[model samples]
Target: MHKTNFAALALLSAACLTGMSSAATPAQKGFITGTVVNEQGKPLPGVEIDVDNTLSYDSSLITYTDAKGQYRVDVRKLPFTFQVYAKMKLKYGDSTVNVELVPNNPDAVAGLAGGVRDFVFKPKPVTAEDPYGNLGRVFVERGIGEYDVDTAQVQVTLTPVGTLADGSAGKARTFKLLPSGGGPVIPNVMWGKYQVTATLNGKALQIRQRTDGRTPATWGAAYTGGFTRDYNALTPSMFLEVRVPRAGD
Candidate 1:
C-alpha cells in the first residue's frame, strides 16, 4: 500500500474509533441538502450520496435520495474552515454512471451556513447496448510493470461534440495510477463524439484503439476525434499504455 494511502486510512480509522458521533448535537448544527437527477433532468431516487468533511477529523456521513430524489445530511460541526462534499455512485434506471465527482470544488459543494444548503447533480447515463455508448471505458497500463502506480498522476480529458443533445463537453477526471496503473475506470459518458487527450507526470501517453471487444487492436487514436460506437459492429475501447524507454530491453 502507498504511504499516502496508509495515512488517509489511519486518519479515518482513528476518527471512526474515537470521533464525534455520526451527527453533531444541535449546538454545532450544520446541514446540507440536495437533489439528484439524470441527464434528461428527471428526479433520481434511491441514489446513495456519501458525504465527507475532509477538513474535520471526525468526519464520515452517508445518505441516500428519497422518492423525490432529495437528501439531507447533518454536516453539523461546520468549523469556520469546514469544507464538506457529497458524492454518489450515480445511477439512472438500472445502470451506474462513471462520473466520479471531485469534491471540494467551490461550486460543487454548497457553502452552507448554520442551516441547510441545497445542491443539484445531473449524472450521465450509461448506454444499455453493446459497445455501450452510454459508458466510456479506459484501461491504464504502465510503461513497465515495475513502475510505481502510486507515483504516477494521470489526467484524462473527454470533450464531447458541442451540439450534443445528450450532454455537453468539458468532462474530465483524474486518477492516482492504479496498482499497476490500470484501475480507475471512467464511466457513464453521454453517448457522443469526443476528443480525448491524456498526459503523464514523467512520461508520454499513447492510446491504442480496439473496436468494441471483438476486433484486433489498431495503432491509432491518442486523441479519438469524435469517436462513435456501432452496436452491431464492435465497441471502441482505449488501450492506454505509458511510453517509458526502459533500460533493460
Candidate 2:
C-alpha cells in the first residue's frame, strides 16, 4: 500500500512538472455546422465565424460562411463551451454577431457530426408609443472598440425586427451617443423589447452586453465586440449597458 501510494504521488508530481492539465475529456468530440441569416431571412454569405472553447485544445476555431451562409468547423470536444463571433460586410456596413451556445448532451445528441444551430442577425429599432408603463432603460456605458476618444457620437438606431427588415418601416428611432458611453435613453414607447444598434462613423460598432451564460458573462468578454445577436435586447424596466469592445482590444 505504501509503495502504491508513493508511485501515484510521483506520477502526479511528474505530470505537474510537465505542465500537463487534467482537463476533463468530454464524452464526445466532433464538428459543428450551422447557417447565418439576416432578419429578412437572407443568408449572410462570407460571414466569419469564430468559436472558442477550452478542452486542452490549442485555440478557437476560425471559419467562414459559404455562399449560402453556411459553415462547418471540425472540433475536438463535445458538450464543450462555445463562444461564437460572426461578422459580415454588408451594404450598410459590417454586421457583427455574438452567440452563447448551450448544446444538448452529446450522449443523447443525434444527426450530423457536431449538430446544427442557426442564427438570425437583426437589430431591433425602437418603436413609438405613449410615455408610460413598465418602461425599462438602456445605458451605453462607454465605447471601447477601436474608436478614438474623439469619437463624437455613435449612431443609435432602434427598429422592430421585421418591420425594417422587409423595407416596410413606420416605426424607427435613432439616437446619437458619445464615445464615453451615453444613454439612459427612455423610449416614448411602452414597456417592451427593443433592438439596439451602435455605429461609429457609419460603421457598425461592436458593443458588449451581459447574457445569462458561463462564457465570461462579464470577464470572458474582453475586446472582441461584446455584441451577440440575442444579448443586445433592451427589456422593459431594465437598464442595459451598451459597451463597445475594450479600447485596447
Candidates' C-alpha lDDT: 0.44, 0.43
Write model 2 residue lDDT over 96-213, tens digit each, in one string. 2132211112122232245444544543222223221122234454433433623335555554444221234435566553222223343322222346566656666554454444
lDDT of 1 by residue, 7-65 (tens): 34335534542432322223224566655555354766766666655565665566777
Query: What would the C-alpha RMSD of candidate 1 be, to one decimal place?
Result: 13.1
TM-score of 2: 0.34
lDDT of 2 at 237: 30
The backbone clash count of each candidate, in order, is 5, 11
Give all TM-scores, in the order shown. 0.36, 0.34
RMSD over all Cα atoms, model 2: 20.8
lDDT of 1: 0.44
Q: In model 2, what lDDT does residue 198 have?
A: 63
Candidate 2: what lDDT? Answer: 0.43
